[model samples]
Target: MKISSKYLCVILLCIGNTSVFGQSTFGRLKQKATGIAEKVIDKKTDELLEDKSGKKDNTRENPTEKVKKERVKKQNTVYDFQSGSTVLLKEDFLPDVTGQFPMQWYTRSKGEVVEFNDVPGKWLQLYSGTFLSPTVLLKENYTIEFDVIIDFPPNGNYPLPALKIGLYDRGNKGYILSNDYRVKNNVNIILSPYRNELRVKLKSIENNSNKIATENYILPDFTAKLGKPVHIAMDIQKERIRVWIDQEKIFDLPQTVPVSNLLNQLRLELESSNYKNSELGYYISNLCFADGSPDTRSKLLTEGKLESNSILFATNSAKIESDNQGVIKEVAAALKQDNAIRIKVIGHTDSDGTPKQNMALSQKRAESVKRELIEKYGIGENRIETLGKGDTEPVEKNMDPNEKAKNRRVEFVRL
Candidate 1:
């Protein structure tokens, strides 16, 4: 029985409601189709299977071989930061600009709890203009919190214009702050001295940064003041920076700085803001930095009631090229200086590739790091804890492919 090749090809291509044909087992269908086509060809138009040359073509009967499958593992990558355990980039102080302050600090209103009858009016204007952090006061691995009151307009600035805290660099450094406040343009006024508290340690560079997952806490009206302090707190865990405002959180911003702020200069500056009345003033107090935990936010205000868990640091999807030599030096010095300090080398990978492959790659990358610290530098091996988290963690997500690629790298996590 001669079955035309044309019909066989059609069956193979699975065109025209091929769904039903595909449902049949591969072997049974092939045989069924071949048998039916043969019967039809026998009775229908007597077309010869052979060419005009009268030679029978030799075509194979069985189906072609199946496609070969490959695991196709992604590129092997790792990250490490010799960053110190707790790099409290030191102190950040707002110069006292209380006297010449033009804000209407004196509005005859009953004090909420009169320690002083003239508790600064409901508003205070923070010093406006450019005040660089005489020095970088923050490190890549850090938890930061500070208080700023809106003497001028109050917290919710539809586009929180004046309040910005993030990576300050030559270009795009502004990307460091929160987008929640991005909608508020109203500037807060501070009647008293302001303090920027940073509790940071250079952490191991990582791949996936956002923790297992995260959620942000927010308050609608946005403004909170009872002659009390308004808080801005940032907790950076792995790659995500959870934010809170006076026990109530506003929003979260991805960690703009990577495992390391290449510049090693962590700074925060105020936007060019002014007092609503030009004669406002307020106080920013309780500035402190601890190794793990510090009382940053006016925790007392909420009476120990905060919505979300504290987020440590954020992850930056910004693709960057850097060397750990500088960090190595800083960390080496710390290791030498602080006898109680122990350095841990950590590596990270973006959430890409299969779990198995990513795990192996990350681990190898970690060991590679262990060798570098121990061999190249005179660091003790016992102090290092090498751990690799594959694509399970993400510094940043829902970003462009390039950003994901950047996040897919490693970090030097301080243990």
Candidate 2:
């Protein structure tokens, strides 16, 4: 039979429509890939910070506490100091980064003070100190956290930029965080010990009775870079200690001596080598010892730790992150007052599944959560969207069966 021209053109149009539909279907099929990454964190973030504590070992008990239980030293004790738990810091502290302060006997070179040697975005050296102190501060059982910057100069004393922490008593002779002058046959090793200088010498002072010296050891593995900043923390409690550098745990040891006096000095010493004249400086600002200071362990655990995303993932079951309905409600109220916010609901799964399966599962899960949030919880759908990342990105690696189980999860984002 002979077909008319008009009828033939209509048939061609239908053919084109069918081809486009087929392409769309195929594109979606490809996206439903199997075993692709989805979680960018690549580790478990659902785990919360856990505080572990135990009684101090009898080996580290104060001699006075053991031998002379009734007699308590009143002067050097921080137990009665006003600087504990809720102490308020001075306002206008470290007023400027390019200034200095000298008290009757002590001096403070902090905030942002520049040397002729400064690179943009590179930190200026900030420091505060007292020449000498009558007693100690954070002793036996305490936690200290603070931010730090490691700086180096092309010409001066300290040639390397490292985060140096030292503890000594009375005399300035001790191991300053593993200053190995013998490394690489570098002759400047003699000065390496001084690079992490300590004013106190534990061996020199006689402990009331225990053979333990006043010198406290922190971490031997703290490293810093020039022109860079690191938020560092060192905690000593219950014959155990932990170190956090830039919100990362570089060193963790359970048994280190404590700083007995609040007068104890915390310094970020620069690295020194035999390599010629180099000005070494470290930016150490916002020094705090209070239990919940702004820059203390608590701060690091919540804000600093999560943002840095440097903490090692714990190999355990996938823990549900607590979402407070009260807070979410409050957010809705805020939105009513100031319009609304855009939020995204994302779904994820482990790497053990095919991409297509994982993607479909993720999409369904995201939609389920979105429906609940909008209908039951009062979050707006227009202000909210859903995404299924499949197994492409994981907060923690599923290198093993245990980790794979932990990677299956969901997340919420408000923008």
Candidate 3:
């Protein structure tokens, strides 16, 4: 009464499609199915199963793993983008239920919070011709950071729709999703990824309904970044606007945005294209809008203390994210300007885990910051002291994700 591996695979597939199988039985069958699959299935099918099961073959190196490691190494080494300190808006789509529109966002077209197969956390998937806007008024000088994933089938040949992000003045109107989504005063940054290259275009409009500045740049090798998470940062300082995709600064103009423009709305649009919704996927998450460029020198040297929300870390870990190293570099520069200055680095966390775990994590985060300053910036180890406050000293109540983000910050105290 022995069954062939082929029949076993078919049985497993049938069980996976139906809910008649219990959890424990399904788990056992899956293990057996994969175990038998390794011997009978082709290499490509085995690889797909491994990815689905979140397992890896140790005998051979995975090209995806190698690329990820290389990308992380490159990110850690190149640190020029500086995120803003004050939290104006932080949207992770954590509270939104899957298959529903986000509660705190306005969209002219349809979108939903969806969880991906390979990526963690929830993302807001935007359809073509969608205009999504967060329900927050932006400040004059602020920075916007978000992670976007444009997924397309590996074998499908399709045109990629451009993603447009801009700050517009909605004439003090309150959270209106207009039919004609255009404003007189706005600064738009468009990212168009084609077959082999990426075209970045920046255009700013003034109150007079005139296109004041327009710039376009092209970057080769965009195929390397497709179907992966790409970090995008936009910094607007009065009349100047700068944008960075990952580590590369694509746009830096001295006078791209008008100083007199009253920009209060942050809009994200997926331009209309011929591709169907199923063919091309557009997902975005971890959106943060922070106001004002951090004055590290003035805050640390003059005020004697600086609380920075820009130095970000991995979730539940002390590993510092690469793009946030600019704030640390700025602090290091301040220390170098005054050799006699010795400062204390204090780490804080939101109320996510237990008190003891939070305490340990905060301490480790403080040590990580100290290590980065000493190792990367050549700051003396003895000059920097470290401390952790855990969730006890939160600047904001841990009510929502935005408040939690404000609580999770690093402080530099001039000692």
Candidate 4:
């Protein structure tokens, strides 16, 4: 009549009531209970094994997630656009006082030079429906570079303001600050950065007639770049036009401008938006206009020395801007053409810092250029020598910002 504790526990677990199993023998009940427990354990064990093996299969089936991460890591490393050597106009808004319109620029609507808490340097904050232009004469072969910042709250869902940069012919009217000026011929580069998408458009017109050419492109990962400084560069060589946003070349057209049309003005227009200025802000700074693309081969070979402002560097740093590597590539090409040539790479800086600091920075910059030539361009390291002149040997007096920009240059001398 007495039962063991273990069997009694098993009997309670299997049948929950001892009276119901009175007719069955103890041995048969025990065997049936053991089989049921084993089957239930086996079923749960199989489910756990399947769960552990399913993760690998899911990863293999969805490889796009890994590929997307790799693409983002390599997005900013590809750069090829180069700026022009001759400095025409360089404006960092350093001379202009904050909360006032820049004296060197012309704008019809409201805009002022303002400093930001997070961003370095002064920026020209342009309001909506504004036409802003620097007072510089645009030539056929020139380059333009600037930095822009899109300001929007992180939680806001409003669309970004549209931007337009273009070259227009205003005839003999020199630097007119008007919203209704009629442009004879114009080539506009429009940028629309929406919430989830980005659109870039190019439009060219002649004699105020129909558009001659229009091109549009949709850029990826543009919305994530908001609230940061974005560099934009443009190269206009005769009828050919090329535009770059950050490191990506968004537009390249062989014949985008009219041959007969003379473009004399460089303009930046901010299209009207429904949002308030505080909700959607657009800021621009570091506007540089350089004229005449340097003949690198001729200057380095025939003239025996080539000085280039196009091979730009970061502020007081030796790291070269990736977009300015085209100038170095050209130098490498020239050296490759003539295997017997040796050259010295010299670096210079503006008169802003101490002479000792400038000298050290310049030396590092020169060495950086040499390393790029030898490593990236397959040039021999022994054939290139590096030197730094600092601010001692300037091309011009450092009286103004443009003059200082001309002084901060890289020189290649035939040794």
Task: Give TM-scores for every candidate, taking all chains together and pairing residue i with residue i.
Answer: 0.30, 0.31, 0.52, 0.53
- Candidate 2 wrong stretches, greater than 4 Å: 1-93, 102-140, 153-164, 167-225, 258-263, 267-280, 292-415
Clashes in model 3: which pairs? none
Error of 2 at 181 (Å): 22
Question: Which has the greatest TM-score?
Answer: 4
Candidate 1 lDDT over 87-131, as tens digits, reads 454332333333333221211221111122454422223343322
**182-264 in candidate 4: lDDT tens per residue?**
66688888888765556889988777664655656887776687778999998777777778887788876766776575676
- Candidate 4 lowest-lDDT run of ten: 171-180
Better of 1 and 2 by lDDT: 2
Candidate 2, residues 245-303, lDDT tens digits: the string is 45444444333343333224432344334443234445544455644212222222223
Stretches of model 3 off by over 4 angstroms after superposition:
1-78, 153-158, 171-182, 294-415
How accurate locally is residue 64 in candidate 1, as Cα lDDT from 0 to 100?
Answer: 33
Q: Rank the candidates by lDDT, best first.
A: 3, 4, 2, 1
What is the Å distance of residue 348 in model 3 from its true position? 28
| Residue 116 Cα positional deviation in candidate 3, in Å, after optimal superposition | 1.3
Q: Tens digits of per-residue lDDT for model 3 on 1-415? A: 2347686766767576657877787777777767766665565566664644577655467889888899787855554666777898898999999999998777658899999787888998988654556556666678889999877654556667888877787733333355654466878888887777778888888875666556568878877777789999987766767788887877766567766646776677887777778888888999998886744554687788988787889999999985353678778978998999999999999999999999999999999999999998889998999999999999898999999999999999999
Candidate 4 TM-score, true structure as reference: 0.53
lDDT of 1: 0.40
lDDT of 4: 0.78
